[model samples]
Each structure stands twice: as C-alpha cells, then as structure tokens.
Target: MKISHLQTRFILAGILLVMTTVVSGIWSAWTFAHLSEVAGRTIQKSQLTTDLSAVLSDALEREDDALLLAMSGDRGQAQKKLDAERLRFAQAFNRLKENLDQPDQTQALAQLAKHAALYRAAGDVLLTTVAPQDAFRWYYQNVNPALRRAVAACAEIRESNFRAMQRAGIRARDDARGATILVIAISAAALLISTLVAVMLARSVLTPIRELDRSVEALRLGDFERRVEVTSRDELGHLAEGFNRMAEALAEFRRSNLGEVIAAKETLEATIAALPDAVVVIDPDGHIVAQNPLAKAILVATKAQGAKIVDDLPFSAGSLRAVREALEGKPTDETRAELTRAFAVRLDGQPRKFMLTAVSIPEFQPGRCGAVAVLYDVTDFARLDELRTELVAVASHELKTPLTTLRMNLMLLGESAGNLTPRQQEILATAAQGCHELASTIDELLDLTRIESGQLRLSRELVDVYPIIDRAIISLRQRFEDAGVAVQVAAGHRPAFVLGDSVRLGMVFTNLLSNALKYSPRGGCVSISVRSDHNGRGPGVLQIEVSDQGSGIAEAFRERVFEKFFRVEQHLQNGNATTWGAGIGLYLCRQILEAHGGTILCHAGDNGVGTSFVLELPSPGTVEQ
Candidate 1:
C-alpha cells in the first residue's frame, strides 16, 4: 500500500492509533507491574525488619530475668539459666544482624553482641567469686550496670531497626507517589498524542472532503471546468486528478464539437453570402432551414397566394423530386438541369431559369441529413449555347455548296493536267485532296451543330461493326499509302454487330483510322482490333482499339484530347502556322460514343510502344435500358 492510494493513508492512520494505544497500554502495564513489584517487596522487607526488632527486645528482657536469678545466690541454677538466656540472646542478636540491612543497624547489633558477652561475664563473676551476702551488692554494682548498658545497646539496636523500618515506609510512600506520577504522566502523554493523532487524521481527511464537496457542488451546477486541488499524493489526490481529467476531457469534447459546429455554421453563412447564386438550405424533413436574400426574393415572388418551400416553389407535380435525389448524392448533370428549369419563378411576368445545386451538409450526427441548394443563373449560358449552335449550323450549311464546287473544279483541273510536270501533278493532287478535306470538315461541322442542338438522333439498329470498320479502312487507304504507314487489322468476330447508328459509328471508325494514318511515322505500323469487355467469344461488350506506332501522346493530355477544340501543345492555325488536323475529330468521336451509351479511353499501346484508343460499347444483348 503506497501513499498514492488512499488505503495507505487509512492504514497509516490506523497504525498510528494502534501504536498509540499499544504504547499507552504498555506504559500502563509497566506502571502497574512495577508498582505491584515494589509494593510486595517493600511489605515483605518491612515485616522482616519489624520481626527482627521484636526478637532483639524479647531477648534483652529474657536476659534481664536470668541476671536477676544470678543475683539470688543459686550458683549452679543461675549459671545454667544464664547460659540458656545467653544462648537465646546470641541467637536473636545473630538473627538481627542477618536481617538488618542498614549500616547503623548492623553496628548497633554488633555493639549489643559485645555488651551481652560482658553482661554474661559479670553474672559469672557474681555467681563464682562473690559471696551470696555481698553477691547481691556486687551484682547490683557490676552486673546490674553491665545489664543496663546491654539493655541500652539492645534498645539502640531496636531503635535502629525501627528507624530503618520508618525509612522503608517513607521509601514505600515515595515509590507509590512516583508510580502514581508515572502513570498520570504516561496517561497524559497518551491522551495528548491521541488527540494530536486524531486532529491530524481529521485534518487530513476533512480538508479534502470539504474541497471535494465544494467542487462537486460546482460540477452539479454545470461548471465542468471546476477541479479539486490535490493536496497530497494519496487517494484524495488521485481522485482529484481523475476528476480534473474528466473535466478536461469534457472541455475538449465541448470545444471540438461546439466550436466546429459554430465555425461550420459561420462558414456556410459566409459561403452563401459570397455565392452569386440564390441559395436555400433545407433539412431532411423537407423544411427550409435557411435561405439567402435572392432565394427569399424568389420564394416571395413565386409563392402562390400562400405557399412553402417544399411543394410550392416552382414547377408542379414533380416538384422537388430532384431535390430528394440531390440529397441522395445524385450526379448533378442528371438533375441540375431539370431542377433549373423546374425552379423557374416569374420575375416581372417572365420566368427566369435557375440551376438548383444541392450540397449536403456533413452529418454531424449519424442518420440525419441537411443539404444546401444553390440555384445558379445559367439562363445566359443556355441562350449563348443555342446561338453558337445555330450560327455554326448556318455557317456550315452556307459553306457546303462552295466546298463541293471547289472539289469538282480541282478534279477537273487534275484531269486537264496530264501534260503538267511531276511537281505540278503533285500539287494538283494535293489541291484536290485539300478540297475534299475541306468539304468533309464543313459536313462534320454541320453534324456537330446538329448533335449540339439535340437534333442528330441516332437510328438504332443492329449495325455490323465489320462493315463500319471495313469502310473506314477503305476510305483512309489513300492516306495510309501517302503516309507510308502499314495498317494491320487483327482477327475479330466475323459478324460483329453493335446496336448503334451505322452512319455515326462509321464516322467514328473513319475518324480514328484517319488519325492513325496522319500521326504514323513513315513505314510505321497501325493496328486495329475489335474485342469486348470479355474476349470476343463471350456476349459481354464491344471494344475497338486503334493504335499507331508513332510518337505516343503524353499521358497527361490523353484525357484532354477529347475536350472540344483542345489540341495537344498546338493552336488552331490562323494563317502563318503549318496545319495540323482540326481538333474536333476526337471530341465528336466521344460525343457520338456517349450518345450510343458507350465510352472511349486512351492508353499507352501494347508493350508501351505507341498510343492506343479503345472504344467500349455494349454488345447487342448487353445494352441496359
């Protein structure tokens, strides 16, 4: 158990209390035990001292009786009595010496022993030497005085013992007083220590608890930022740390979520403000959330007596059907135009087109959605496209008759140049070819205008790809011969048929063939193969690859080549520059393929040799409705 954990604090506190109690208990036991030991020993020693004092006094009294008998003049009887009394006194004296511990008591007992011996000698002289008549007088003069001195010595010995006993009593009282003082002192110290321990424990515990209560109250009042200050590296400290961490996590969560949402909201508002288009934002429930000024104006003008954004903004019946699709992340091309025309609201009694573009707001919460619909003003662009197509149509049609006349005159001139020089003949031939190319270019321009104006409809039929490919090869044979390029048609399906317009697919084939020959180096080989998404045997889909063994197109510009009027590293020649073919061929090729529900891709040739163009189309049974 470490202080890092609260258990340590509790355990430590308990240990302190237990130690205090144990120490107090040990002190109490020692105090009582010592006092009991001292009391018992003192009682026993005092009793022994009193018994020895009594023995000395009794022996002295008995010796005085024997000396009285000696003064009566019975020599034999007195001698025997004296010997008995002397023996008894000597025994008591020796016992007193053994029992007495004080030095003064021992000295008094020694003096008493000497006086008893002198008294015994005086009694003997009275009995043996003095006559009975004068014995009484001699005894009274010598033995009686000696007896008195011996009794005085005995009294001194007894007094010393009494004094020793008195001292023992004083010592015993002092010992008791000391014991009581020791016990009281130990108890007071224990009480003081216990109080201190309790105060310290209460302080350590209650201080954190008070702080914790205050912090918790703040937290309850929604102050997630509130934190407890850690005072010690204990349980409360760790708890405070945990609380702080929780608060920090919550704070960070709020910052990330609320801040991003507010920022995104502001950014959206700013974006809408900046966009020229009229914008409307709506929720998944088809209710309007926000709208720009232009959007508001459009709604105000378009509202039918009383209306809302969901069902009454513009064109009826399929109103906002495209909006639902847009919310589903539909491709913009499919719905944007429809929505644009559908969103028409009369401004000054004339309807204006608005391209409706719905952008989804990110789902902040899962399974809920909102979208921003912006209506772009594409009315001018739409009119310009129409005008440009009409102009191209009129110009192409107007140039066709003259181009034909020019072609005929060149042919006639070629017939009339039989006698001309080789150079002149070559020039004549080039002139005729150039005229033919010009006529074809004008025709293609007319067709391009029709395609743009949605009038060049494909005649759906099971057209044989073999015929289209064969005709394209035959039409470009002269160019292949002129460019000295070899044409290789790989083995393909015999009756390869695709559901497309024969004339338009033929044009696509011819254009590819022409490009192959035009870009091919002298003596370079051109390869054409017809396959499918699967091999040619499977009823999968169709692919026609036209490849040229010449300078390959750079990878970056391959996709851009199909964009209208886009030329790779070249501009449309005005007058001074040499001519490259018109950039419209690949563009028209892609448009025609897409109109037939197919696509085209350009890639490096087999073995990275040259450029390859692959045209993919649905085989007969594989076309989707």
Candidate 2:
C-alpha cells in the first residue's frame, strides 16, 4: 500500500505538470493584459473620433451658414448664430484634444484647430466689410478654403484612429494565434509526460488511496464512526492514521457539545416564544421548520394555503423575490425595504396590518441556511394614517366646488362695479383679490390630493424644452415688465430635449420664474439659464436655473422651502398684490421632478444677491447608457 518507485515517478510528473501550468498561465495572463490594453486604447481613440467628428463637422457647416447669412446683410442675426456654433465646435474640439494623445491624432488635432481659427477670423472679417460684394468676396476666398481645410483635418484625425484600431486588431489576431500555439504545446508536453508515468504505475497504488478517499467522504457526510486502516510505515500509513484520529476527535466533540446544544436550543425557543409578534422559521428547501404561538394569528389572517411560508406570506412579489435572493446569498434592496415597512393582509372583509422583518440564520447544516420572518401587529397605527390621508382628500374635494362658485359670484360683482363709489369699488377689488388667493390655495390642495392618491399622471413625450420655457416666460412677461425686472434667457443652437409632460414641466419653470419676478427689486434682473451635460456614460443631464437679483433666502430655510405648505413668513407680504405665492408650488415642483427621476434644489444666485432654483433633469433617448 506504500508509494513504490513507479508511484513516486507518477507523483513527480503531476507536480511538474502543475508547476509548468502555473508558469505558463502567468505569462499568458501578462501577454493578454498587454494586448487588451492596446486594444482598449485604440478603441477609445476610435470611438472619440467617430462621435466628435460628426458633431464638429455639423458645427463647422452651421458656422459656414452663419457667414453666408452675414454676407447677405443680416450681420446681427448671423453673429448670434455664429457665436453659438463656435461654442459648440470649440467644446467638441477641446474634448477631443484632451482625450487623444497619439502623435498622429495630436498632429491632426493641431491642424484642425489652426484651420478652424483661420475660418473664424475670415468670417469675422467678412462680417466687418461694409460692401456686400466685398463681404462675399472675402467669404469665398478666405472662409471657404479655411473651412474645407479644417474639415479635412478633422477627417484625418478620425482616419488615424481607425488605422490604429485596425493595427491593434491585426496584432491581437497574431498574438492570439501565438498564445494558442504556446498553450497547446505546453499542455501536450505535460499530458505526454503524465500519461507515460501513470501508465508505468500499477493498479496496487490506488488501493490505499481509495480507502482513504472513502473514509474522508464518510466524514464529510457526518459519519464520524468510519475510520481508515494503516497497512505500512509510509505516506499512506501516516495519512490513514491521521484520518482515523480526525474521525475519533469529531465523534468526541459531538458527544461533548450535546448538552450545550440542547441548552442553546431551549434558550432560542424561549426567546422566540416570549416575543409579542408572530415568528416563522423557514429552512433552505422552503419547509416551515418552526413557529411561535403568535404565528397562528398571522397564518389565520392570511389563510395561508401553500406548502411554504414564503409563498403564503403577505408581502408583495418583489419583497418575496428579494428574500429568496438573500437566501441564495445575493441580497437585494427590497430585502431591507420590504422587511422594514408595513405589510397588509385582507381577512374577513377587513385589513390586518403588520410590520414585517427578516433575519438570516447561520448554517445549521453544511452549505445550507435559513431565515426567520417576524410580523408585529400594527393595524391600529396604519389605519390612523390611512384615515388622515383620506380625510384631507375628501375635504379638499368638498371645498373646491363651493369655492369655485363663490369666486364666480365675485367676478360677476366686479363686472357691474360701475354704479359703486370709489371706496366701494376699492373694497370690492380687495375682496376679489382675496377670492383669487383662496382659489389658488384650493387648486394647490386639489393637486396635493391627486399626488397623495397616486393619480398624478404625466402625458409624456420627447419635447423641445426651449419652447416650453419661452411660453412660460411669455405668460409672465407683463408681470415682470410691471415690476421693472429685466429678464434674460441663455438660448443655444441646439434644442434641450427631455421626456416629460410639457404642461407640467412648463408649470415648474413658470413657478420658478414667477418667484424670481416676485422677489426682484425694481430695476433688477431675472436670468434663466439652460445647459446640457453629457459625460459619455449614460443619458445626459439637462440643468435649468432661474435666478433673480433680490434679497436671497436665508440658508436655514432653503431645504424647508420644498416641504408641503412651508414658506418664508417674511416673504408673504413682501411685495404688491402681483407678487405672492402659496408654499405648495415648490413642494409640488420637487414631487413632479422626483417622479421624473430628477431633482430640484434651492441655492443662492450667481452673485449671492437672490435665490436660485436649480432643476436638473435626466435627458431621455438621446444617448446610450
């Protein structure tokens, strides 16, 4: 049963094969890493050139069109268009310059930058020329050639990247073939030597190994009674003796832990039973192992007819899936959220609510685990919350109709105020203003009810947001003019697109602008800025900020402004009748933006003199994720 001379040779061959494989694997990994790095760099350069080339070329064309327009005697409009296009071109060009560093790409970029500058200079000169013919002459002679050269240089950069990618691919193909041949050669060499030694060894060498393997397998299966026999004073003899001692030690340990394990089990059972909530333990195969006395109440409420506790549980499918995932060693978000929140079960025409939780138990058997679910009755507290929300919804609905009728009556009175004295008319106007504010509050209340009821639906489409903001500005133009507050919009060459309800998004912008106009002092300016950010990772972000030159909001009140029905008391009557707002506007803005996977924040204006409402929306469908 000992390892004789031939068996020793066979063992040495195995060790040699393993060593050879390890060294070969390390070298192959390094070679593959080098090739992968080369390919990655090439692909990155190629992709940048491919994406930016089209964008830069379009910008160049647009700039050329601007020059044409300027030569046709529309210098003012042309200048604006040219500025936008130049900004676009410069952004794309600069991004490309920073990312690409290969000598050819760098040289091509330099050429493109030079030609683009020359083209821009020529366009500027054409714009300055007074005579139309002179302008046209300068544009055709200088602008056209420079634009062509710039475009050609841009193409050269793309071509250089593409060529590099091709070279990378060719080298990768050759390297892959070499790596495959090397692996095959080493594998074949090891296999031949191992097979030769194994063939030379006899069947007698496996007798003791098989005996030791059976005993180890028995130990794995908890059969500590099994032991191996030693037949010689060699390696197998020592291994057999070691396995026999291990089995005996395992048996003795089990025997000694029996009383301790019983005590622990009783303690655990006592703890579970003393709980005020229902608890159910489930094993790895979805079997219901144990339950506390309180668990019967939950089972009865749920009418749990399934074989497994998880399937019969009252949690939603998503929560159940998360629990199953956890049991499989892949925890998920719902695992925590669902277990911490209240779950409801319908029973006998009434709802029973419970706060649910789950905890994973340590392994009781090899490679297996289980989980415990606890359900604490919270029916009374949950019902109170539901009733409160329902009461608000009902009250808002009931008050809306009556308020509308009263407002209509007030409007009728105002129309017939010709017969009244001046003081009477003034009083009537004040009452009407009060009615208007009441109406606004009622509308906000109705909106709040819909949001609470989960009935706020968005009629979504890919909308060009510039027009929406333009309309928002137009609707409030007279109020801003009356306040003597100048308005500024930073328009761009491209449309800012987002997937959202146009009307709702417009409301958000209108609300922010209205707040700006309301807070701005006389002769101050309100500025609206829109910018798109793309980082080549996912869909781009669209940011819009509305700022004013009024006393800014206090830092302590900034975050609180977005809470429902919360407002700055000092600003309630800070301005004339035209400049007041209900606090729910910003709260609703936050809600609507959150529903669209976006966010809104309040910050100080650019000059720290007024409030800025910043809205960041994730653009949809334009860029790959």
Candidate 3:
C-alpha cells in the first residue's frame, strides 16, 4: 500500500516498539530458565553431599559399638556387626564416588575408602585375639584414628559440594545481571533508533511544507520564477509536484498576458502618433502627462526654450482656466467657447491660427482627474475664409454700380408714367422695388465681407451708449409698430460711455431690435436695457440687454445662431409668410462687438418666452459716472 508520510512514521515506530518488546521478553525468559536450572543443580548436589556425610557418621558409630561388644566376650556377634557396618560404609563410599565429578571430591572419597579398610582389619584383630581390656586400647589407637580420618574425608566432600553450590549460585546471579543489562541496552538502542526515525520523518514532511510556503509568498509578490523541488514519492512529493506545476502555469500566464499588454500599448502609442491634430494629456496638477508628436512639435514652437514637458502647456490663459475648471468637475461652457475661437501663434517665422479645445477625461483614477487638450491648426481655413470674403466683396462692389444705374433708370421711368400704359408702369414699379431689395442685400453682403476681411476700421471715441441705443430704437420704432410690437428702453441713471464708432454701434443695436420685432408676436413687448458694470475682463464696462417676447430659440440652436448663414430650420420653413433676413445680421453684430473689445451672447428671456441679446462693451479709459 502507498503510505503517506504520517502513516509511514507511525508504522515504523510501532514496528520498532513491538520488536523491542518481543526480543526483551524472549531474552528475559531464557535468562530466567538458565538461572533456575543452575539453582536446581546446586540444590541436588548439596543434598547428595549431606546424605554421604550422614552414612559415614553412622558406619563409624556402629564399628565402635561392635568393638565394645567384642571386649564384653561376644566374639561372634561383634564380628557380624563389624562386617555389616563395614559393608554399609563401603556402599556409602561407592555412592559418593559415583556422584563425585570434581577431582577434590574423588580424592576425598578414595582416602575415606583406604581409612575404612585399615579400620576394618584392626577391628577384626581386636575381636579375635585381645581381651576386652586390650580391645579398648587397640580401638583407642588404630580404629579411632582411622574413623577420624574417614569422618574428616566425608566433611571435606560435603564442604566441596557446598562450595560448588555457592559458586554455581554466584555464576547464575552474574549471568542474570549480564542478561538484564543486555536487555536494557537493546531496549535503549531501539528507543534511540525509533526517536531518530520519527525526527527524520517529521523533517521530511515539514521541509517541503516550508518550501511550499516560501514559494507561495513569492508568487504573491508576483515572482513566478521560483519552483518547489520534488524529492520523494509520498504525499509531500505529490504536493511539491502540484506546486511546481502551479508555478509553471503562473509563469506562462504572466508571459502570455505580458506580450498582449505590450502589443496593446504599442498600438495605442502608434494610434496617438498618427493623429493629425496635436493632442496633450494633462493631470490635475497641470503637469503634462502624455503628448503626441504633433503636440510636442507645437509645444516646442510656442513654449519657451529649454522648458520641460512637466511644465504647463502654452495655451492661452482662458484655455488654461477652462482646463482647470474641467478638472475640478465644474461647467466650462463659456471658457470652452472662448477657447474654440481662433488665436494666432508664431510657427516657423509665420503667424498661424489655431483653435484650442479641452475636455475632461473620465475619472480613470480615484479622486484624480485629468484633461485632454487638442490644438487644431485652422490657419488654412481662416485664410480661405478671408479670401472668399475678399472675392465676395469684389463681386458686390462690381454689381453696385450697375445696380445704382438701374435704380436711377427705374425712377426716370416712374416719372414718365403719363406716356406709358398701366401694365408698363406696374412693371416699372416692381422693377424699382426689386432693385431696392437687391441693393440692400448687396450692402449687407459687402459689410459682412469687410468685417471678415479685417478691413472694417473703427473710428474710436468716447460716446454715451444710451444715445446710440435710443437712435437705433427710434429708427426701428415704425417697423416695431407695424409688426404690432412695443419697444421699451431702460438705461441706468448714469451714462455708460465706451470707445467705439457711434454709427457701427448703432448698427449693432438696430439689427438686434429689428430681429426682436420681427420674431415677436403681435402686441409683444421688446425691452432694451443698458447698464454699466465690470465685464469680467476689467473694470468700467457697458452691459446692454435686448429682450423680446416671442417664440424662443431652442437651446440646441443657441451657439449656432452666431454662425454665418445658419438660420433656424423652423424659421426657414416659415418662408415668406414671416419676416426673415439672409442670416448675416447676427453674424455681423458678433463681428462688430468682438472687434470693439466687446462680447455678444444670446439667452432665453426672463420668462423663457423669447431671445435675449446681451452685449458687453469695454468702457473707455475713463467712465462718466
């Protein structure tokens, strides 16, 4: 069976413990058996020695009694008793000799036999020839000495057996002690081996675990190169194998994804580089984060020498404000509009027009916002617009002379109506009216062309804006009345004077008032208000607002209303039923106001019923308060 590391350790320890116990038990049993046998032999030899000593003492005592009987004159009975005693003594000596295995015991037994034979011969002489008195003397000399020698020999044999038993007991005890020591040593060795095995097994299991732990930590830190080394065929080895596999998989994943990520990054960089317009990305701190080639080129051209990319870009102050406001998550519509206007920059020793646009990038990082600024080169477009305007101006100027001659001829024809038919006169009148309308259209076109071409020079002077507004209102008063609209002028108590041409300023107000009257419903009120205030750029500015009650301009068309030739679609659909102009009136107003260092904006009226045209003009060096 395939045992796990833990199971193997347990099995080995158990086997060692069982083997140690069984061997110790067997050894103890064998030692005790050998000791018992030695003890038994010693006890039997001691008993045999004791029996031989008793037989020798009895034989000596009976021989002495027979000698006394011979001294008493019973010769036959004494001899018979002596012979029986001698036979018993010989039998005891022979039994001791058969049992005697040691050399000392055998010599003692032979000496005892020699002493008994001499004592028997001496006892027989005493019983056959000597009187009773002589018997006593002989027994005291020869027989008594022989009996003493035999008794001494028997005692020596018993002492030898006893000493042998003592030696045997001592040897048995030493053997038992040696056996105990051997068992103890074997048990100790077994325990030591088992402990070492256990420790080795534990280390075998834990070493891999520690290695795996370190590998896991490395993986967490994104280091996928380290792998666990496999060194066994147990569960720990399998775990190491799995861990190494996991590391390989992670390494592969990182390589594969890294390649794709690098590819994607290159593609993005190439795409940005291929863009036509200059693109710059800035962080919230106004530092440049990234830029395309065009952006770098533009910056190098416009920015200061030796400036770093981390520095703020060279956009106009207004554009910088818009970018900051966007980063702060605030509205930047006005600033954005200002940025979209054409601005001049020197590039390669030539002045070029560029339009800047900034937009906030979405919250890509928490609490950190960024913005993208685009610089569009519109120099060619502006030059084209200027050229087209010049061409139109030239065309308009060429048509004006013929148009004036036609108007004069029509007037002459009208005066001669008496000589003409009624149909001819009617045809002459229509021709005169058509020529007037055409002349007015030509005049508007010429004025727009002059404004776009930068040829509309202003004669600057300090003039009160109220009088200019009043003159414009009076000139358009009859038209407003015909359209069933009312005109109201409200000026501040103090006069608001600005540096501008009075005629041009009046034209601005006239166009605004005329549009208000045209778009107003019957009996709707058109109010003109002029006030003096700061216009955000500096102190001492004039603010004028013209509001009318009419169908309001849609929010979508508000910005486009100032665009050239762009009329609201709904107004165009109304056609001839409603009063309409060629749409350059508002465009001209914008150009005129902008040229005078002023601004014009259209908004919904207070009640959201009509359009409000707001004009801001910079005050002259001095303000009349």
Clashing pairs in 3: none
- Models ranked on lDDT: 3, 2, 1
Estimate the Cα RMSD of every predicted model relative to the unseen true structure: 15.0, 43.8, 18.5
In candidate 3, which residue ranges exceed 4 Å CA deviation?
1-255, 303-311, 317-355, 376-380, 406-443, 491-496, 533-539, 570-580, 620-625
Tens digit of lDDT per residue, candidate 1, span 1-625?
3367567666777887788778878877887788788768766765776676566566666766766776664656856776776677667666666767789977887787787778778877876788778877887788878877877886786677668767877887887788788878877887888788779878988999898889888877878888889888877787788888988887788877997999999998888877788887777766777777777777778664333456655644443666665566553342324222335566667767776666666571367666667777777776776687789889888888888888888888878897899999999888888877887788788878877767888998987787788888888788888888889789965666788999999989888888877777899999989875545465567888999986677776787788666676483234343337777889899989999999999998878888999999988633322
- The full ranking of all candidates by TM-score, starting with the best, is 3, 1, 2
TM accuracy, model 1: 0.51
**458: Cα error in model 2, Å:** 8.1
Q: Can you list the residue pairs that collide in candidate 2?
A: none
Candidate 2: tens digits of C-alpha lDDT, residues 1-625: 4453544656776787677678777776777787788778777777877899778888999999988887777879988999999999989988888878678888888888889889888777777754675776677778899999988988888898788678778888898888778777866776776666565543445777898899889889989899887765666777788888989998999899988999999999999999988888888776678888767666766666443657766666665775576566553443233221467776567777777656666683468777777776788876676676678778878887887888788789889999889999989977876776566566666667677667888999888788899998997787788789999897663577899999888878877887788788999999888888866577888888888988888886787788766768645455444444677889888888988889999998786789998999988524222
Assess each prediction's global lDDT (C-alpha) against the native: 0.75, 0.78, 0.79
Error of 3 at 219 (Å): 10
